[model samples]
Target: MLWIPATLAAAAAQTARNATQRRLTETIGTAGATQVRFLYGFPFALVFLSIALTLSGERLPRPDGGFFAFVVAGAVAQILATALMLAAMRERSFAVVTAYVKTEPVQTALVGLLILSDPVTPGGLAAILVATAGVIVMSGVGRGAGASWRPALLGLAAGAFFALSAIGFRGAILALDSGGTLIRASTTLAWGLGLQTLILTAWLLALDRPALTGSLRAWRPSIAAGFLGALASQFWFLGFALTTAANVRTLALVEVLMAQAVSRRLFAQGTSGREWLGLVLVTGGVGALLWFHA
Candidate 1:
């Protein structure tokens, strides 16, 4: 379905947006860089919502307490996940960090079942486990020059929060009582980004004024990254509205291969034999998931 391609597009956009944000982190610092996505993304999210409303002729759904709970949970968990990931980046290589965060498929399944009552088929569960094992094999846990548990802890925490964010966003999207999936997804995006913008802006203003100014000075690239971030989130929410969060997340394991391809093309890096094997396993697992589910 469209959710499959939509999720694929989100993964690619997220990779590109993160590359831009990595450069931003060097200038504005991590927290400020994280804020850029919210600050700049909110306007684009509003635009998306406006377009969806006009096209669908749907009024905004009246949000209930569950909607607010889910949205706030998604917003706060994502922010914390970003922060922890940035912190882990300081301690681990990008490959290791991403692999750690990729554990979200398993966690997402558990969270979705627990909180949203989303059910996973037996085949789907098998695919998730196989893909997760491949990801762990690819992580190269001891391949680092020197290792510490700090980054590992941070990475796992980031993965858990990310899982929470996925469940929360899916919950938020499903909580809507009216509108098409597109309209509901767009509406959730608008509210989520708006709340995140307010929260991060207030924090930056109170504690990190210089970083805010630095982001302002680098507005050109910041806006580019921000726009891409919003674009990715839009499609992500749409995917959530269309399918279970666990399925969306399991398919998203493709991003690991995407990141490797990006690094090879842009940074003159290459994967090893073990990584290739891992790629094979992940591909096989994901292929089986789609095949069985189809």
Candidate 2:
């Protein structure tokens, strides 16, 4: 029951953040908007981390060499994922893109089992299969929206990167021996976000000065989106620490339904029959996971 509400709240918050990101993407382009999210939000995360450290009376852990390496690897994977996802957003609906991204739960579970040696039960595998089918249904694989294989491929790559990011953060959390749960999670998030900011800022400056300059000029909106993104990530990291990454990410699929709602209200895009079916499948899959875990 505790996991139920916590997961639902995280999912809701993430959906709102993604909606803000989608709006920013429209104005600045995906890559530029992602850079804005990290650059503008880094300070807020730093402030939060500082407060957390002070209150907890804990010094930042000296991350093990391997831990820092994992963090960098995760950061790189996330950057690549964000780039691909932004590009995919140009050609795909937010709902479709998000639905595809939810496949990360499956990928993460597999990677966790293979690399981290996390065990998976039969029920978990069943839930993953159901959820994957829902993603396929929502993707309009056979229906005609002029959807090509390219967007799906990019979305899958995004999911893979997201899986790597999860594993990296989890590894970091395991490495830390100091601080309470909240403090540890917050510290890891601060470093991860900080690394992402550095990498993305450099990437933007090198490849697209105009977009970076434009994003800076639109600081008001950019900052708002950035704050939401940071806050959303904070909750997500906490959830990751408390639960299995597979479970947390599987529940995060609710973001797709939330995105669909946003599209209907904000863009006047109605949900299609196929999308409704997909929703039913996704809901059932989530229910199954919860039931089995319970």
Candidate 3:
């Protein structure tokens, strides 16, 4: 499926966005940096939606209760997930934090099965496990860092919330029968970001004006991160629309590899032999997944 490429591109773009956002988080609070992805990103998402509609010549699918329910759930869950991730990052090392977050693929698979009735074959299940193993190792779960309940629970909860967000968005897109997959994905992205922006803006207006102002003041970097955030999400939605959320998220584990490469090239960090082994397993798992689909 074209979702394979889409997922790969999303992973790379998302890694860049994460790096940008991480820097921004140092200047602005985590909430503000997190809000940037939704607030500034909505405009780019709108642009994507426009292009998709223009190319497909499809009318905007009117949102019914089911559509809004899913979108709203996804939006809220996504925000909570970000907050939890920020909190986890504060409490633990990046590798430990990411190890917890990487649990999302497995959680996504289970949630997709239970809520979306998406089925995975035994081979598909095996592929997911293999890929997840690679991701866990890459995340430094092998470092044995989940020692405390606080950070561990925070990370696990964040992963679950992220899983819920994926499932919600996937359900929302599939509920829209009036458009092509591109149209469906774009529409979902636009609405989800819009809702997230509104909610986060309202929160900042009421409670943390400085963080909000800080985000606005840091417009240049914020915009770059926002644009990439939107771009990554656009492709993420496309993949979700084309296949099961489990499959999409499983392949999405390669994001860690992409980020690791960036660290190596940009930060001069070295990868260990174990990391290379993890990469090989991820590659093999991806091949197995593709074969299973075929």
Which predicted model would earn the best TM-score? Answer: 1
- In angstroms, give how far residue 7 of model 1 lies from its true place: 0.5
- Candidate 1, 82-157: lDDT as tens digits: 8787677666556556667887899999989999999999999999998888777776655655656678778888
Better of 1 and 3 by TM-score: 1
Taking all chains together, the TM-score of candidate 2 against the true structure is 0.93
What lDDT is reached at residue 39 by model 3?
Answer: 89
By TM-score, rank the candidates, best first: 1, 2, 3
Q: Report the C-alpha lDDT of model 3 over 204-236, residue by residue, as the tens digit.
A: 999999999999999999999899999999999
Off by over 4 Å in 3: 90-96, 140-153, 267-269
- Candidate 1 yields a Cα-based lDDT of 0.86
Backbone clashes (count) for model 1: 0
Higher-TM-score candidate of 2 and 3: 2
Query: Compared with the true structure, what per-residue lDDT tens digits does model 2 show for residues 157-227?
Result: 89899899888887776667766767877878788889999988787889988778878988998888778
Q: Sorted on lDDT, highest at the top, how do the candidates line up?
A: 1, 3, 2
Please state every model's RMSD to the true fold in angstroms: 1.6, 1.8, 2.2
- In Å, residue 94's CA in model 2 sits off its true spot by 1.2
